[model samples]
Target: MNRVNQVVKMHLRNKFTWFLVPWAILGANFLINAVIATSLNDGEVVNTGAIASIFIYTLITGTLTLKETFPFAIGLSIRRKDYFFGTALTVLLVNTISGLAITTLSAIEQATDGWYVRLHLFELGFLKDLPFIGIVGINIILLVNLYFIGFTISSLHRRFGSMSMYIFFTAALLIGTITSYTLTHFGLWVEIAHWLANNYMDLFWWMIPMVGVYMIISYGLLRKAAV
Candidate 1:
């Protein structure tokens, strides 16, 4: 492993303090899922707190570097590329583990009710087919992409180095809102909505192809940038 990767792995291994993340996530998830479960009696619907926990954790870790912590990463010889990769790997690992834990921890009324059957990491139940090997493959691939996502987020807007993150986040929200509104209003989903929704795995599979693109772009982004 490279120095950056090693540093990150160690940080992940030393996650005694990082347990705070999951605790916070658990608190948030209970609040959110309590309302959801009360309204929806379905076991899967009510037991969504596990999924909620992972989502909350990722959002927090992914945005951690938005604050300038160059001194921290630099001392560890963690390149910008490495930092995000490590962070993403950490997020994916944490989420996947957290996902399983949440699924197991969920308190359902019925004996066999659960929402932790996602075959693909991104989609809720992407890996419902493969039995054993399929689950393993999906997990491995997810870890890779999450590392890539972490890398991508880490390398961006480091030059402004200060409040650029606020700007970046604001701009991202603005762009996302406009794009979502446009796509929803436009006839973008006229035909494939059902197919896409029913076979949502297809949507997440697109990430498999996009991973390479993100890695390459992230590398160039962190090439000369100080983070």
Candidate 2:
């Protein structure tokens, strides 16, 4: 237990990778959006993908967390299971903090009408309509799933080298293409869209199980991983 706490504190103390860098990117995006908003004279510009940068940043951070920390943790005589659990704990804690902060900013954006400049940065259509708790839930779930996916991918690289990663991605791309082709052939786009519209929030719930799956896979790979 103490070792787990130490590991979490070690990552937390680094501050730059898991915390500052990601927020810095978000701040930069906000600044850019603010400037663009000022240039626009009449209407609102919906920056639907602006918040996405932070999530993507989290994925990179997660990958780096394991890639950079696992070796050091092992050198310090930390057990692999403890390190894995600690990393998982850090992911949850960091994502929860980020999710709450984003949710608050999103609420403010809604109330101020995008800082009175009519630039929709944090408030996207899907997110803006959700209640406060719902928004936080969605953000946390998205962050967790993305981080775990990145962590799992890094674990794969650690356990099976770069070739396996390449093959996995190629197969995923092919499978995705085939699935899309099948869906298009059946003209299920509209139905899919409708379902998404009605149950988008429910989809976030699916991330819980998805996260669990990734957690198990990452731990399994890490157990056999070379430091």
Q: Pick the candidate with the highest TM-score.
A: 2
Least well predicted 10-residue stretch by lDDT in candidate 2 = 41-50
Each prediction's TM-score versus the true structure: 0.60, 0.95
TM-score (C-alpha) between model 2 and the true structure: 0.95
Residue-level lDDT tens digits of model 1 in 1-227: 47656755655764643457656656575556566654565444432425444444544554454343444776767666676566555555665665444333432212234333211112334444445444544554554566557546666655445576688789999999997888888867665676776876665577688778876766676676664
How well is each residue in 1-227 modelled by candidate 2, as lDDT tens digits? Answer: 99999899988998888788889988999998898888886776546577889999888876777778999999999999999999899989999999999999988898988888877878767666668998898889999999999999999999999999899999999999999999999999999999999898788889999999999999999999988
Q: Could you tell me how far off, in angstroms, the CA of residue 67 lies in candidate 2 after the best superposition?
A: 1.2
lDDT of 2 at 222: 95
Residue pairs that clash (backbone atoms under 3 angstroms), model 2:
none
Worst 10-residue lDDT window, candidate 1: 114-123
- Please report the TM-score between candidate 1 and the true structure: 0.60
